[model samples]
Target chain A: MSSKPESDHDVVVAGGGAGGIGAALGAAKAGARVLLVEKYGFLGGAATSSNVLAYCGFYKQGPEPVKVVGGVADLVLDEIKGLGLGCEPFRSPTTDNWIILLEPETVKLALDRVLDAHGVQVLLHTRVAAVSRTADRLQAVTLAGMEGRWRVAAEAFVDATGDANLALIAGLPCRTGDDAGYLQAATGPIRVGGRDRSVPIDRARIVAAFKEYNWTGAHPTARQDGGIFAEVPVAGDMWWMMYDHELVDLTSKSFTQAEMAARSAAGDYVKVLRERVPGFENAFLLQTGPQIGIRESRHPPARYELTGEDLLSGRRRPDGIARAAWPMEDHSVPGRPVYRSIGGEGFADIPLDCLRALGLENLYYAGRTIGADAAAYASIRVMGTAFATGEAAGTAAAGPDDRIEGTAT
Target chain B: MWRKSGRFQSLAHATAGEMPAKRSCPGISRDIALLLLFATDDLAAESVAGTCNSEAVSHHGLERDFCSSVILSLPIPIMCGAISAIQGHVLGLRR
Candidate 1:
């Protein structure tokens, strides 16, 4: 074995999604030499790749919208606002929660600028091929990219891969879905342009027409859904359409089939919109998401598992590091989603233990893969909550001996 | 029973197809009841805000007047009709 450390860094973060970006930024800001590795060529993972343009869970939902998370999340929003690439937070007509809509292309540039400013080294088009561990501590992670195989050795590691890929590879115990392993449905949001801004299309009519045409794909009930269930206007005459891909496994074959299915569905949906829906007479498809959006997959076991009961009860831990204001939006069922309000102040605190893998000393995780049961995961897996958790993980990982105050259970 | 709300009444009128008859399943009704409880609480608090005329403001400097106008004029049920759709699948253990 080679004696030299393989490309040393203070912190290494896998996955370039919201959580990964947060981890990289947080570590860098905390005075650590950080490296962020992403499978895509660009920065924003789900936001850019999956065309998930809206940032949810940023604010408490009720009669009045209240901002709950600040710090790195604020920096990202401010940068996007300064660049004039995002929309001010507006109340969602369906959920009544405040959401920030962004231009996907601009978001890529915004993330790039933020990471560059923080001196975080980014490796795009790179994925974690293997992980090396000595007993309970992770030593190095081997990366595979166009440049071929290379190893990165770091003092701490953050598994922000959305699927807990790093932790699973490191031989840590992880869970998926519930005890039954049922994951929430995936979506591939498509961009549509040339929509008539002067006239509003009737969504009910569109859905009815889609059903009449018998193009429901895997979701036969495409009539009763309520979770961000319609096309959102991103810019003038442009909108992002969210379409369901139903239950898809985390396999390449399933992903390929899902992509083809989404593209075909987008085409059909657009055709119906132009033909049946009045305002969309001239609407055309711009592009489908670069990849299918996976809502849930593998969740690494943490020191403490946040459960649905916790969210419903509005449980707050003394070591809470962030707040999730979104409701329990379970998209596991087809048609309408199951939404349970956060019982207390309309927000639930996420403790630091959720980010630390139970058996591993230096391994951490954030984003959708954080330790949570199905319902609780749905509430906190939104992009905004992911940012908060990622920031906490990065901050904790960079601290001495992971001794982040207020994080102890 | 839920149709007593002005929003559901408006939703019933707006959609062209027959609305699914009041769901009789106990589990589904319970879930719907819980959701409605939250919805009604917010609606009651928000009624004083004047007919949901809030504009759909885009931070990117684009005006969504059409969307804002629709949201303002439509009743809660109509808005829900516009937002809800049916997709296949149910939350269960992975088959």
Candidate 2:
């Protein structure tokens, strides 16, 4: 709905996460001037900021790992492979879902190189603070950085901030967590070093360690069962995600508390591992977090909300822009996650309307900001699916000149 | 350094999910309070400024130059505080 006014860039993407990366690269590759804004100093969102050192939703759950996400996402995988890190899909022993293990440093460097190659203008350490909009169209966003605040008008905008920060600031109606206001518990994944790699990880020993820790240790873990544990690629360190905490609220106070508690528990858990587990006699906490991994936050409504029924049925649409293959991995309860598989072909088509914001012509949704019910959101919010939606939104936001062909509603 | 305000006293050691509000931006004051609490360890703008100067020189020359000119214009300590204050101001934490 923009009146072809003079603007800073053709497409402006807020947030530097997986979704933002996809959006920026997609728009730029589609022959549009793209600007990507991230709050962190680096590019990888949760992978770099938080300790989520794994790329999920890349494959489906089966005896064989079937590739689901492609397009611009392949660029990252190719770059990662070029960096000498394994880009192969590894089956998770815990969830049985295939994932690509990651090292934060490599991911950060790879993302930087790929975005640069694509000619996407990346603004690190910058956040989109305020938004200017009309009744049905968005005009510009004020970016707050270390230097100062500046307003940059754009023809189209993509909200990939994971929290729907752009939509919220633009006064768009958004849903928080679920309809009942219950959010999925956030996790704090840790990397433990000095572990003896000769001996394989024993699940029984981990369960026993938590049992004793709960009885005697200062910071007891709620996850009694051995949580997601695997060896990180390249570094050979242990990547464990046993620590889980429910976010009391969305405030930074609760976030800080959870972060501190996770750190404290991380140290305590490492000590127990060294004392009990045979392979972890010298185990030490290598990385707790620069920040905690948040699962869900805000959801802005789109033209059509992708429903749980659609996901369960694994429906394919004529206007499908992306395919979401990840299961409905719900973490509604702390330390207890339930994953429901997609029916039919084990992948559901995400319609293009799911990325189009309702009542707004120029604004689009990407990543976790896409409109979906709670269950569908759980399925589509992973980083792999994020790339698909982000690319679709960015391509659409380029004003149909280079819009993707053959996807007709 | 930022001091712990009384608003966080109740939730300081809370482990349960008994929070009051659900999903609103906790306003700017609370954001400033939280930022201040962790800003020291969060590292200042200098780290990023240094990366922009070195690593990004080959890939993103223009952004690197802009970052360097803007950041290196002032001393690191002053720039750090100023950037924090500027961010707080933009977030409505300061008038």
Candidate 3:
């Protein structure tokens, strides 16, 4: 044990999302003591926090659903299926890509159970306030929670905080958004209730409504065509991604402004839906979200930065630990997203080096924190891919000689 | 009737094409529901071209899943059409 620190754990994961959960469980399963810290009151990251309720990259985008991510990720799926909800990959008719629909509350309980079963110690409502490190190694992280702040040392650290919070605190080289510093627009996905379920939803009607609303509505939406809508599993309500807010800056105040703008837009959108769309005549906003879904933010550099060419070519590597199957879904412009499909075998291998921080020896990254160029980042940043990368990061963090088991297939 | 599933507390609500077999009309089966769920975008568009009649129901295995029986059924055509329309957006999708 490191005698210089207040407390010690084998691995300290700084996020409670898919990546962090995967890291915590992976390290614990590999016979290492693990501590999982979450900024939110509960786990499930974007699913519970920002209402981003789908797990992409689990399956390839093809005629038939081919499982791409497994290993530790299967444990979460098993728990979800044990909860009696079908864990089948639901294909998005528009993109023809496979994604596992998530019900946040169910996901929270399932994650809690899975982490507990693996004996991972969890601290909720906690944030990684600061990091203590040497020239090449991280020593400890100061955690702020309701109980008060405390310092905990760990032999290995995994930065799965999506926004690269750990790496930024460690003074590692990081980039914001793309090389151009333009971030993808943020989205506020709301659940609409009080809908007339008896009547069928007409796309043309909604599109016509959006056209009229955009012309003169108080809160005009940038998404000219109506945004993505899906059936939220448990609630039986419409999960609508109608509002897109462009982030002006990385400051908390800027994020607050975008969030409020989206919330205001959500109100006006529901009103338009009620007045114009048929089935949504009585539609009420069930959930606007606790916060907007951030598509891109701070990205820390890694040992090897994956590029768009690798994704386009579906490049494979001997040291690859995870698969990047989702397309390059770039949303650099607000209300606009561009998707470029994976070439070759329809998936690219993310080498272990992509998860290892460039300068920090013991610091690893998972989820959106993994090193990737803008194009590659768009493909590998989804929750499902995050699980695969996180497991590899956790496994690697647990022991220097350990390799991920049964994941690349 | 909507029944609550245990553990997750999810309402056993049927999605576009995955209606309960028991709730389906005389000819529709679970396998048929699965087929309808994975049907091509063209098929969905063509299905919407016609009205919700027995001819359309029998040909596409809609029987009760897409048109009649289930209390909480979301028709496949409506769902797929909406998705296709979004994909048609100038900024969102490109082949």
Return the TM-scores of chain A for each candidate in numbered order: 0.93, 0.95, 0.95
Over A17-51, each residue of candidate 1 has an lDDT whose tens digit, in order, gives: 88888788777766788999999889887888988
Q: Which ten residues in a row have the lowest lDDT in candidate 3 chain A?
A: A400-409
True contacts kept of each: 0.00, 0.00, 0.00
DockQ for candidate 2, C-alpha atoms = 0.01
Residue-level lDDT of model 3, residues A1-409, one tens digit each, is 2233377998999999989988887777656889999988899888888888889888888889888787688899899889876779999755678999888889999999999999899999888999888999999999888877789999899999999999999998789988889888888988889898888777788888888888887667766557777788877888888788888779999998988988888888888889988988778988977778988899998988999999999986645667888999988888777889988788887877888898888999989999899999999889988888888788668755312111101
Q: List clashing residue pairs in candidate 2.
A: none
Look at candidate 1 and tell me the lDDT of residue A238: 48
Q: What is the fnat of model 1 with respect to the true interface contacts?
A: 0.00
Is 1 or 3 the stronger prediction by lDDT?
Answer: 3
lDDT of 2 by residue, A342-373 (tens): 98798887877788888888888888889899
How do the predictions measure up, each by TM-score?
0.76, 0.78, 0.78
lDDT of 2 at A203: 89
- RMSD value for candidate 3: 18.3
Runs of candidate 1 with Cα error greater than 4 angstroms are A1-5, A215-221, A225-234, A240-242, A402-409, B1-95
> How does chain B score by TM in each prediction?
0.23, 0.29, 0.23
Give the CAPRI class of candidate 3.
incorrect
lDDT of each: 0.68, 0.76, 0.75
TM-score (chain A only) of candidate 3: 0.95
